[model samples]
Target chain A: MSTIANYGEVQRALQTDTEQILAQIPVSPVTLSMPMDGAGPRICASVKRDDTSRVPASVNVVLDGNPVEIVVEAVGDYQDFKAL
Target chain B: MMVNEGSEGRGGDAEHFSRLFEWLNTNADRLLDDPATNLVAVGIGKKSAGRIDDDSPFCITGFVEKKLSEKEIASRSMSLFADAAAAVSNVGQPKSLDFEIDVIETGSRFRARPGLQFPAAQRGLRGGAAPTLDLQKRFETIRKGIGITNPHRSYPASLSVGTLGFFVRDEGGTTFLVSNNHVIADENKARKGDSIVQPGTLDLTQSELNLMPTLAKLRAQLEIAKLSAFVDIHFHNPQAIPFNEVDCAAAEILSDKRDFSEIARIGLGGDLSGVATPFTIDPVTGEVTGLTRVYKAGRTTGWTEGEVTQLAVVTDVRYGAGLARFRNQLGIAASPDNTGPFSRAGDSGSAIVNARQELVGLLFAGSEMQTLANPIQPVLDALSGALGAKALTVI
Candidate 1:
């Protein structure tokens, strides 16, 4: 197998782990992309939670000694994130 | 009167009984370490209806290896100290002040039992997620042992006061109210300098705090280093360290409005609100040393007392989404006769103090049978190291 195949195996494993986590948690789900240089995983999600619950500012998942940040969707001009 | 004679007759007996309790407490570890004694619990008790050890009731109940006769216990009691033998071998008749040892079923260390009814405190990640109880009113007073809430979580729910715990000072003389991170920090969902409301959002109704007399805000949530040595995290997740381990938080409370020194109903660990007890920390290891009986006032069960049953306990706990493991945690079980429990769901963030009034541990999480706390020494160190707090002293 080529080096690219090895990276693919690791990425697939992370996706699998992410799936397992999502099934257990009440979180907005998304895939984090690992950089080709293996610097870290960058996370972005266009997910919105509609529950009446006040959610956390950001959720973090650690991939390969680095963090992938999951930002809770932005709502309106009522920006209390800095205060909360 | 007959009562007066009874009391006067065993004056010396009661004194001995009292001293024996302290002796037992000091030697608790030794006693428990041995299975031969079969001693599970020991506390002062009333005179049983038929038992003769009434004048000085010292109930010694446990899973006796064998039903120890009064003579055997008297021998054991005499073996404890030289003077104790005199109480056992009093001429013709034995004074009823010997050992009233009763062996029965096993006793367990009490954990704060949680009752989750409403979707708020009742919400869980998985299976045990059934709504069994109903939304009910909680305490209104701003003191310890009353229910509090973190409105910042977006879901207003009730958690216990866990005492006002302590008043920590920054370099500028600013004081902050302390509790578990889950309580004041909303399980890592709060910003520093934000408003932390006492009586929480779900105490009485949506606006119970609005109608109440004292309204307090939890300032900004302060962070502490997850005692990795005290906690167990699978993957190196910096985020999990703040959310999961050591379960403590502090928000600046205006001293003019509410007193951090004052505990809710129970006065500061026996009326010691303002006075600060000196505690010892291993400068090298950051561990609390030489701690004894500790107390905490919570929202649900009110004032509770127990001994540090175990120390340096490492275990995993579940937050909303996942499991976070912690290490170097202190173990506290229910007091004898079930007076105080370490923590329940609402009981998180209570201050655990010793008889000397030293801040010993911070009550954060637990099973229904026992509670766990992060040692206060390391917690205070974490504040200064990670959160920029210096000269952290309890007011």
Candidate 2:
């Protein structure tokens, strides 16, 4: 568990992991959220149900040399949300 | 009669709530780290009905993806200051805050409306190929929230349309229509002097015609459809730092001098007519504070309201062929009272404003769960640089 003091470092690690996951599997929408209630320093990788085979079930990020699992949820098909 | 209870207790409660918030802020990471808590976000709000803890009307509001049963919640024994429980007893509130934590379920994914496509048969032949008298009239009366598009695309199938968010005036007194880069500049494929039309190709009602089958015919049609005041769009390049902070662009409004003066004075109007004039940004952070109640007038959804679910959010969004990562974007979700989503397709260029009518963010992207906006300060700064002016003020 990260304290408020070192929360920045934890967030950076999560972002790096998210970037790596996206690079390995293109077009998978991923996001990071603050520890509001359920989890701290978390990243949610949204994968397409059809392209599940291409995406990992979970990703691992090293925090203080300890590995934490980041879950990749299989949402339906990927949607192009920018143009709208 | 209630005044006999005195103000001391009320003041103590207020101070206690503030301290509780401060404590929560300090230990936020630890509380969420424990999966048993099931909290996705936290804030202070009025206690909802049918809660076990009703001693106080106010409590530490905990937003969760799902709510657990009272039995399960109690079994988990979620404590606020477990290590210092003994010391906290001296405080006003109980050491165990499980009863005080209100759990509310909220969907948290950040994306925009999907699979939005118009029929090719309905494509505008009049605007893209040639402008009609009706479209010319619509173009003259430009206003915010009206549909705008880049008629001249590299490919005939490339149809780009979005709402004109706001009218902003630079230091030079040149007013411009603000919107997303993808809407006006066609995701950087459009040049500075490209023709941008009102009512866009999607909004036009004219019947389709494949009149420009040949290159010569295409050029001739382009010439005929070229409504004057060709929009000048410029996308400012990010300096060294990677990732885009904003998805914004400004199109110079080149209406007649008389029309320009009218627009500058009264400002652009549409569904946003009631929005207060003398535009300003959130003064606290030079942008909107988190968890703000906001509303926007857009092309597709018209007018809608929502609350900022989070801020300083990092998310990857799809833009054509590749995924562009956006940093520090605002995540807005439907307000608790409003059942419908905040935005939909064609609402991309709308402006998100607070209740005070201050420009907070530029609506760009979203999904069913969350709508994303770039903080208005960064947007204004970027446009200011691209326009080569000291500053651009929202009018």
Candidate 3:
């Protein structure tokens, strides 16, 4: 079970495992964000749903002796608010 | 059906006629609902020519959909005369008080009659005239979280709408409405001194469609309504700045000095102070230190709540043919308790506030699931440089 008590572990994942994963991804649009779902500051990478590339549903990156979770979501492109 | 209190001698008769007018107007709804009456419209008018003497010419006129035969009229109890006579007698007036009901055949369907000055006989009575309301003043009072837009190109053509984000004041105390450049400035299309209409162009079009019969007339009325230009917008698109910091503009409100300074539909149990300041962010973590939840009152959504789902987000947003890239933006997802999405199309330029009602960001873009806002402090700083204000502070 992952708890929010490991801020340092999450930071380590962001600097190391998250960066390496982003650098290797072939998708055109990918963003890193933090979702507060009681799991504290965790990384969520949103990718465009239309892309043919594949993304892992969830990845646990180990920092020191602790594991941090990174979530990937497939979403539609963002457009400015002009009624279509 | 038109009810007229024919032109009678002025004296005690005036009160009688006034009473007659009041009765007819009060029963208008009942008259319309009764199929026997066959009344399509009601108003005060002169009695039919030569039907009555000039001294007593005014009567209550009822425009029937069609001319009914005497037999049909009688069968339907379409007797305004007997009704008025009975009404006068009820009030202890002389039974001889001869008010009239002139049933005319319009021979056409009567829709809403905007042309009719006083559609109801009651409107012609004393104390009937309402105080002349400055409708334009109501429209010109630009407040935060309401619909507003600019007329960049032509009438009814280039009518795009968005929300007024919030209000800001310069060091000199001049108040201005802060919204997206796409909203007040039309994404770099509108010029200085261009009209920024409230309720937006779409709302104006819908209003005209309901009131005006013809498209040409609607366009004309829209042209007159263009006078709702509430602010003189100042914005700039610097080709030098690599990436846009905020999709924001400041428009100095041009209306009279009446404190229009308020946000719509939010108090948060005394959390709001009529002033909005952004939340502080951690420099190293790039996280809004204490901001957990957010809220907004927008043109479309009215009021909504969401959780901070993303921070320091860099996304490429589509703006018609061009794409403007924004960085360091806050992303929000609809709160679990919200009934619908956090934001919608017309919700752009809404001020995103935190649980404490502190201003957090200026919402500019979004998808069905996520809403994006430019952090508030950066938006203020950007507006300051563009509008040449020493500093801009939310009021």
Candidate 4:
């Protein structure tokens, strides 16, 4: 019985890990460029995610040493995860 | 006489017996009806009640739910309540008993509570819980490093003030010191004969070389190398640094007694020969682009650096005729540091330079990241006109 319980616990842990990894992936939908007053143009990119129930994830876009922009999106549905 | 005594005795006995019988009748009825009444009577008999006299040793055990105004409840009463709560409990029956007292919550409003202890004096009253002389003493060491006379009067480390100098020539050929219009142009225009003092140190006793060694060296090198052969070297008096507008100004030499030779020193870092070092300036538009490191020396924080952030930022500045627009001006923004903005409050009119210490712009207005500096070309032109000298190049 103990071994059976341990197997269930392991499966749940694996499921949680998979969910976290899936949440990190984003699907970008649109991109916009905004000009700064004195600085160069700032680019903003939007992404769609699969897990809509969880908080959105953000990714940093860096080119060379300077920071470019951050792309963020929320996860949507189980079908989207399956498609991924 | 025998009859009289016997009669009086009988009368006294009768009166006593009568009183006892009345008490027994009244108590007997109450005791028979309610067992609690008997306990209350016994308790009352044990306690000496009436009004607690001044001399009486009264040990008040239970709290009083008085329907009195909070004003009526003196500080002494509040203290008594606090003491009572802290004292040993007396309700032997083990049942929880609550006492309520009405207090003023808001204007004309009252609130009641059960078993409420009296409030102590306010926390800040009587210098309670406040930093005393001990705190001042503790920070005395830190205060000395910042040159603060008193810790209590010490301002935050972030605040700073700086001063810059400018010169203006009058019709009499006497070159007078002039700063920003805002500085000298008060309600009444700053006229000739108006007393002007240098903002910071006025002591000329110290060696001008040691005071600004870098500037002195630069001037010496320039004069020796005959760098002034190409550009005119004019000296002037320092004026009051303004708070607003472009911090630009010039001063007149009070006497030729000043060491003009020190003004031409290049190796000392006051050299204007490198003032025209070329940076990325848009040929057609005159807009500054890309990155160029700039430096500035001021009366306050001394020398600091930043990069030119923008060019031709239109800002309205207050002049004699209300607000006037200035265009195509240079704006240099400095990187964040422990001391902040390559410039601060008192750094107005400081000459902004580059890594080579070339004259780049003039330090004026800035807060933290955002700083604005005026290009040196217009300033040099103005100074040249005032000093009766040919215009020098400032890229």
Candidate 5:
């Protein structure tokens, strides 16, 4: 199992991976996905339905790492653990 | 929805018609939720002095498309604002709208005009009303500097910087250096309480941004309005939502004698002595019309003049890497001679004052033919509420 702990690894893959380079980096090998479930940012009642026509949008692309975005929350909080 | 407030009267002139403002703020969601509404703009202002019987009654004005007839427009508007105290619960309550709603129909679909407003030769300089501002005194009272972000050892100076628009105290007695988000916050690179410098990075060498003493701490714009009120930031453009009427930011000044009237217009004293309504609209027809004169004093342009062509305009402006849509902005252009402009590159945060010496708006962006400014009323309100200000005042 691999935990790509930080964005640096993803960035490194994009810059040096031969396969990614050949593919012209069209799709990110490691993409970030913001969960939209009840645990995520608020969504309207309509978002639950199969068709999400009514769900509000997310400027995640333009505002991916931008400062303008306030972090609403995280899906899970983690604590440092070590195997004894 | 015109916001070109023509004149400021004595005594009761500073009134903002707070009840109406708060009413609209609290319940605007109902109207915006319906796509069919297509409600373009809204504004508040008094008539020009002597232009009407009494400029005392601060008016509530709104703007929509002209396709709808006089009857249809009024009928729909009344429906939205109907039943004094029922549907829109806050309509008639105390501290709610005390004035009547006047809806106007715009001739053209509002599309933001954008470009850069670097100074230009005034095709010609004509004589007009003599300026009331004490040029030398105004310059002496305030600090003149650039808007830069985090300067460090390697980076030296932040890549972004621009003009220091104005300085004023919030209700909490906290003083701030006012300018655009791109200017003070470096297009999103800065955080609250970050250090800022004058003679901005554009004006200063990287070495200077590193050496210069910090003049102020950054203040979060506080414009992160309620999420649910807006449709979605997840869309093509975000300003289309509620509560984003301006693109202003502030830095808590270390300590300086700064006021909203840091710079004076060519024809006025350098003091925002009072606040006035943004513009006037016809009660029955909803056509916006009022005081057409306005001016600004900026870093690059110095003192320039122009006409308030349109008020309450909803348009998109490009900055840095993306486009941000701004609504309820004042549009100015060189009249008579099609090429006249009011500001330039280093002038993004200058105060937009009317001929009567009242603070009208905050100059920010521009294009070849148009200069854009966030109307003054909303700027003040955003600071007061979002920033937790008690009694914001422009000296």
Candidate 6:
């Protein structure tokens, strides 16, 4: 019985490892060739809601674990919160 | 209404006529309120030092209000004055009659009988004698400009009954009253010994003979009262720094008896009834989002409320430094009759409070319907450092 339980645990761990490998495969990774002095590579991410009519689109950047969100509106245009 | 005093002879007849004339003058406002009484005038009657006659009855030779048919008004007023004249004649020795009524030429076209001296005639009386309409329109304009969401009391500074003084404190514990440097320095030739009467008070209009006692009383009151330090900047160019903006200065108090915090609380108390709070634009969407509720309390307009229509707006406001770009400016577009979000001519330095009566902005300018205000935190910081006292915070 003890041997059967151990085998079950090993199978579960193997499945988790396989899922992790598949998750990374779908995303792309990039590296900066020449980084500017005070500026780091800028990475932008765009997000859209499933119901486009209900929620507006948004853009965000993650810098040093800090997430800055930008709101884009149809009327007034783009605005950065911190800058205002 | 006419009271007829029969023709008679008595002493002090001139004095009696003068009293009657004064009575008519004082009732001008009330008479004007009557729709039937189209034209009202202040008539001065003069008689050659000692002659008397029946033709000498008080005459209504001119018009004061418009809309009263000229012919009809003339006949009616003449009859009324004739009645008054008869009453006066009954009281005193009959005297030769000479009388002139003062009326605004624009509204009242009735000419002054020749050879009778009268004060300068008031203008804009004819088609312009729409005091009711004028008052209503002016009220509406102010209400729209301030974004009236709620009704409040407002009195013109030129016609107010009290004085409003601003005070500031410095780090050294020195308190000062912030006002136009001229207000204290007596620039524009305000004599040093001249009294500084509060705006809208009788003292402001008192003659020298009547002003002495009032001035003396005020002086004595200042002697015992907590006097705020006065600063005289002496900046007197009306064109350079308009009185509205240069109208700002601070008075320092020696004691910490009052501060911005106290003012905030007082404002909140005044706003016990909750009000709508307004919000600025969401920087991300450029969309106006947030609370749309806003309110303001000024010396002139006691307290008013309105809604915010735009946020983060960039505008060109002409201030002391000429036209400058105002970024992230919040615009409150109020509905008609709501006097909030903006200060009028006399409300130059009033602090703008939120629905919670929290200090949020300072009202400085506005149009007939839109008002512009500066956020409170920045003003508090700037003035706090300059005042040397702890900046009052909005709870």
Among these predictions, the greatest DockQ belongs to 2
Give candidate 2 regions above 4 Å deviation.
Answer: A1-28, A35-80, B1-140, B154-158, B207-242, B257-291
Expressed as tens digits, the lDDT of each residue in B1-395 for candidate 4 is 01011222333544534543454454434433442211111111101233333222222122233333345545334422322222223433212212211111122323555553444664345444522122111111110001001001111222112243322334455444323433322212334332222322222123532443343332322111110101111111154211221334343434332332233242223444445443344422334443367665555455566766544433333333343333334555565542565655545556666666566666555534445565666666655664466543321
DockQ scores of the candidates: 0.04, 0.16, 0.15, 0.01, 0.02, 0.02
- Which runs in model 6 stand beyond 4 Å of their true positions? A1-84, B1-197, B200-203, B207-249, B253-281, B285-290, B318-325, B336-342, B393-395
User: Which 10 successive residues of model 5 chain B have the least lDDT summed?
Assistant: B224-233
Evaluated at residue B366, the lDDT of candidate 1 is 70
CAPRI quality of model 2 = incorrect
Whole-model Cα lDDT per candidate?
0.47, 0.58, 0.61, 0.34, 0.47, 0.34
Query: Could you tell me which 10 consecutive residues in candidate 3 chain B have the lowest summed lDDT?
Result: B224-233
Q: Which candidate tops lDDT?
A: 3
Model 6 per-residue lDDT tens digits across residues B132-159: 2111111211111111100001111222
Best by TM-score: 3
In angstroms, give how far residue B254 of model 2 lies from its true place.
1.2
Pairwise TM-score winner, candidates 2 and 5: 2
Kindly provide the TM-score obtained by chain B of candidate 2 when compared with the true chain B: 0.52
Reported per model, the fraction of native interface contacts reproduced equals 0.00, 0.40, 0.21, 0.00, 0.00, 0.00
lDDT of 2 at B91: 39
* lDDT of each residue in B159-234, candidate 3, tens digit only: 5668877776788877777888777766666677665656566666465545754435443333212211122222
> Local error of candidate 4 at B155, Å?
24
**Residue B60 accuracy (lDDT) in model 5:** 54
Per-prediction tally of clashes: 24, 8, 15, 39, 21, 48
Candidate structures ordered by TM-score, highest first: 3, 2, 5, 1, 4, 6
Answer with 5 or 6, whichever has the higher TM-score. Answer: 5
Candidate 5 lDDT at A64 equals 32
Across B1-395, the per-residue lDDT of candidate 2 in tens digits comes to: 01112222434666756766776677566556766556676665545434333444445565666566656667777533322222233334443343244455677623566653567886664235332222212344455666777666543555445777887777777777788887777776667766556656565433422644433443333221222122222222354214667887777765542144444343222233323332222422233224377888777776678887554556667666456667667778878876578888888888888776677788989877688988888787788777787987777
C-alpha DockQ for predicted model 3: 0.15
